[model samples]
Target: MLRTDEILSTIQMLHAEHLDVRTVTMGVNIQDCASADVEAMCRKLRHKLTSRASRLVETCDRVGGKYGLKVTNKRLAISPVAHLLSGHDLNAAVAVAKTLDQAAAEVRVDLIGGFSALVHKGISSGDKVVIDALPAVLSQTQRLCASVNAASRRAGINMDAVRLLGEQIKAIAEATADRQGFGAAKLVVFANIPEDNPFMAGAYLGDGEPEVVINVGVSGPGVVSSALKRRLELEPNLTLGELAEEIKLTAFRVTRAGELIGREVATELGIPFGIVDLSLAPTPEIGDSVGEILQLLGLDAIGAPGSTAAVALLNDAVKKGGAFASSSVGGLSGAFIPVSEDAALADAATRGHLTLEKLEAMTSVCSVGLDMIAIPGDTPAETIAAIMADELAIGVINNKTTAVRLIPVPGKKAGDRVDFGGLFGSAPVMPVRNPGASSRFVRFGGRIPAPIQSLSN
Candidate 1:
């Protein structure tokens, strides 16, 4: 039970800080909707999603309004579409994506995920079809987001899938050249991807998830930043250790708020409540930034020498607090540093303080990797794959979840600006170092075996 004073304090946070439920995603498993007949499958999928998610937005709004808190985005995540696309052609794969887009529109959700494939070991014929159709499917759809799991601790890295995705990303960028490769922004490639994540571009209903569940994403980078500021004002002599504790305690409160809101909405919808993902997901707004939190933690810039250490500390503390606060905590519940989505991180990139190398290093300790980063138009596909391979390697070896959402902006060179607007935000195209140098390495398309540590069982 939440104390009256705690509720009041949470209300204060809503007004004083950029505190809000980032997303309430309904994961609807549609594996049962699969059919060899493409038309039949599409019909079943459309009906299922629409019927299941029909009341999602209304319920979220009603619950949030009751508590005087806003649910920023209402979303949906389905079981991997590729799994349902078995025995289907590329054309059928694309049609399924369009169907998903239509369902999301009818339900009025912010985004719909699970146009995904798990190819950590190898790509299936169905997965191959989905991958091939991504350029057109992503360019044609607005609400549909896609993800591919190309690496995992047990299966290591599927360089074949990585190679294919690199080419597909390039094709998707070209397909959406009118929008400066905005299509790539809707796609993520992952290593050890989580099934229960409520965030877009990476969210998917994992095979083990319930037929229907509601996962809540809680974001409070601004709240965390503001708390640190107040604490420093009160105790100017506090050390880093003490500051970490403060961040942890604040995260606990944030997680609790999310859990309370999530359970209420789930109960109202008659759906089982999922986990609270306490990720310090930032926004383009000036104050609501994970980068700002880093600055408050004594970094002059986000890509500075001590940046990785700062991120490691922040991630550890967030996970610890979230775990303690909610036994049902799941998903990638840590700080996200998407370059374009966070204004400070974008500025850091423009200032040359946040280079690709530095960002990659930061991903080793952060929630996700290489997110929403735009590189020069001419950057080679092999370079993009190499970047993904490096990030995935970290996750595979460390047994963590990491992902890449790199957009090679079409017709844009290094230092050129491109605006995706809305939640997608904008960023200057950063140059890929030694652009074509990794072609030979990436061309070795095969599997990289799992490390010995994967034998933990």
Candidate 2:
């Protein structure tokens, strides 16, 4: 049983901090909708989404209104579309993506994830269909998002899939060149992608999850930064240990607030509540930035020498706090440094303070890797694959969830600004240091063997 007073106490702290649930994603298993006939499959898919997610927005609003905690985005995640795409053609893949878009629009969700393929070990026929259709599907759809898992801790990295995705990603970008490669923004490449993440461009109903569930994404970069600042004002000479404690406590309270609302919304919809992802996901808003938190931690610049250590500390502290707050804490529960989505981080990129290499190093210790970064449009596909290989190598070796969401902005050069607007924000394109130097390396494509660490038994 939940105590309203205790819950209200949690909500009070969130209200004061001006914190809100970043997303409330309903995960639905749609594999049962698969059919040999493409038309029938799409029909079933649309009906299933509409039926399952029709009341998601309404329920979230009512539940949030009860505590004055706004649910910023309502969305959905479905079982990987690849499983249903088997025996289907590339055109069928586009049709399915279009159906997903229509369903999302009908249900009032911001975006829907799971037009995805899990090719960590090998690419199946269905996976090929999803990859091949990216150019057309992404260009035509509005609210559809896609992801490809090309590497994993247990299976090592699939260089073949990574290389293929590099080529396909560029095609998707060119297909949407009018929008500054925005289509690529909707697709992410991952190593060890989470099953129940409520965030976009990667969330999906992975195997072993419930048929229907509600997952929550609650990010409070502003709240965490404010808490640290207050602590600093009181004890101007506080040690890093003490400041980390402040961040941990702030994360605990924030997790509690997010989980309570998630459970209430789940109950209203008569579905099981899933995990609360307590990532410090930043926004373009001035005060809401993970980089600013780094600055508060005494870094004069965002990407200074000790930036990786600072990110390591923040990620560890955030996870510890969320874990202590709820046993249901799951997903990527740490600090995210998506460049364009974070105002301070974007400024640092523009001023040459943050480079792609520095971002990769930080991602080794941060929650997600090299997210929302814009690169020169003319970058070679081999270079893109090499960049992904580096980032995924971190996740594969460290056994953490790391992903890449790079936007190859067409006709844009290094240091050129791109305004994606809204939560997507904007960033000056960061130069890829060695454009085609790694072609020989990526061309020798094969599975990079799993580390000895995978023999955990």
Candidate 3:
């Protein structure tokens, strides 16, 4: 259906700008793997995951090679273990987590999410157990990822659940202190968590999803940045609207490429295609970064004065383009600004050009909130809670999905480096000036009432 010129442009963009499908995530519901006997349940869970995902990574890689596209990650997301752990003890939950970890390793997937709980309203017994087991489970396992939905637009923010999660996050941090609380890197606390996300540590198979499905996350920050740079070079007086249109057209091509790859993978794997997550996920690579896109928008540095506006424009344009390209687009399909993952952002943090406050401001328009950020090791639990509360408040008020994945590197002071290695690049431990000052405010814990707009429905 593409014209000759458009097709050539797409090929040029892909080759020059590092455009590629970011992730091919398989969602597998594990509720049916539950059983009265803990051992039986764990065995079933392990077997099912191993059988289903054994060829996932291989298939994705093979397909990527055929199209000359790089599939960055192959992952699995299962039903929240909390619902399946109802009436089971903490030991049982850990056992299930071990099964998940083993299965992930056996199948050679990078990460497996859904050590999760949906407690936006209140915590059930199962939710409490899964939360309590997090510190031990995450510290003990390697590939399993966890998330908790502590707030939602319709149900309001559960301050009690948020408080508990804050404490749990601290415990997880302390437990993995040797790795600078890198265990917490595998966990996310969210507001209005999406069910079909293919990225982690936020991806989880929600209760309403089917038995098995394939969800794709397509990334093209480099592609967008290249387009913006070209436009600016040609027309210095290009309006913001014109810049956005350029991004939209580039995003449209990227989304189409992802849809083609994802559907092909799904068909080969014999699973229903879920959605395409048209998120501009970044990496530590030089040209493949969301922060570079911000820089291309004329900011000398990523967190400068105009950074948030640039991110807002980029996010909106990417969403608009993806929506036009595919009716099945879902997840946090916008620009992601994970601190450690983007080299420019990391450099800005090291140079003191970016701060936690600026990152928080940028999250208002970005896909994920406060992602892969490392703070001072001695940061108080109350401050972490306040940070999360602020981010969740934004999502609740705006009726969008937002999450916090803060890493409190134990024993590391401000400006210290915490190296996570691989795609979770190293981050300088940023200072948190006022740590425990928010304790009194957080102690008066109850539901933060829903925003006025939420009541209209």
Evaluation by lDDT, superior candidate among 1 and 2: 2
Model 2, stretches more than 4 Å misplaced? 1-13, 454-457
List clashing residue pairs in candidate 1: none
State candidate 1's TM-score.
0.98
* Residue 261 lDDT in candidate 3: 91
> Per-residue lDDT tens digits of candidate 2, residues 1-457?
9999977645545766658899999999999999999999999999999999999999999999987889999999999999999999998999999999999999999999999999999999999999999999999999999999999999999999999999988899999999999999999999999999999989999999999999999999989988888889989999999988999998998898899999999999999999999999999998889999999999888898999999988999999999999999998899999999999999999999999999999999988998999999999999999899999999999899999999999999998999999999989999999899999999999999988874655
Worst ten in a row by lDDT for model 3: 448-457
TM-score of each predicted structure versus truth = 0.98, 0.97, 0.96
lDDT of each: 0.93, 0.93, 0.91
Model 1: per-residue lDDT, tens digit, 1-457? 9999977767668978989999999999998898989899999999999999999999999999987888999999998998888788888988999999999999999799999999999888788888989998999999999999999999999999999899999999999999999999999999999989999989999988899999999999988998899999999999989889989999998998899999999999999998999999999998999999899888997799999999998998999999999999999999999999999999999999999999999999989999999999899999899999999999999899999999999889999998999877889999888989999999999999998973665
Identify the runs in model 1 with alpha carbons over 4 angstroms from their true place: 1-8, 454-457
Order the candidates by TM-score, highest first. Answer: 1, 2, 3
- Model 3, span 224-303: residue lDDT tens: 88888888999999888999999999889899999999999999999999999999999898888988888878889778
lDDT computed for candidate 2: 0.93
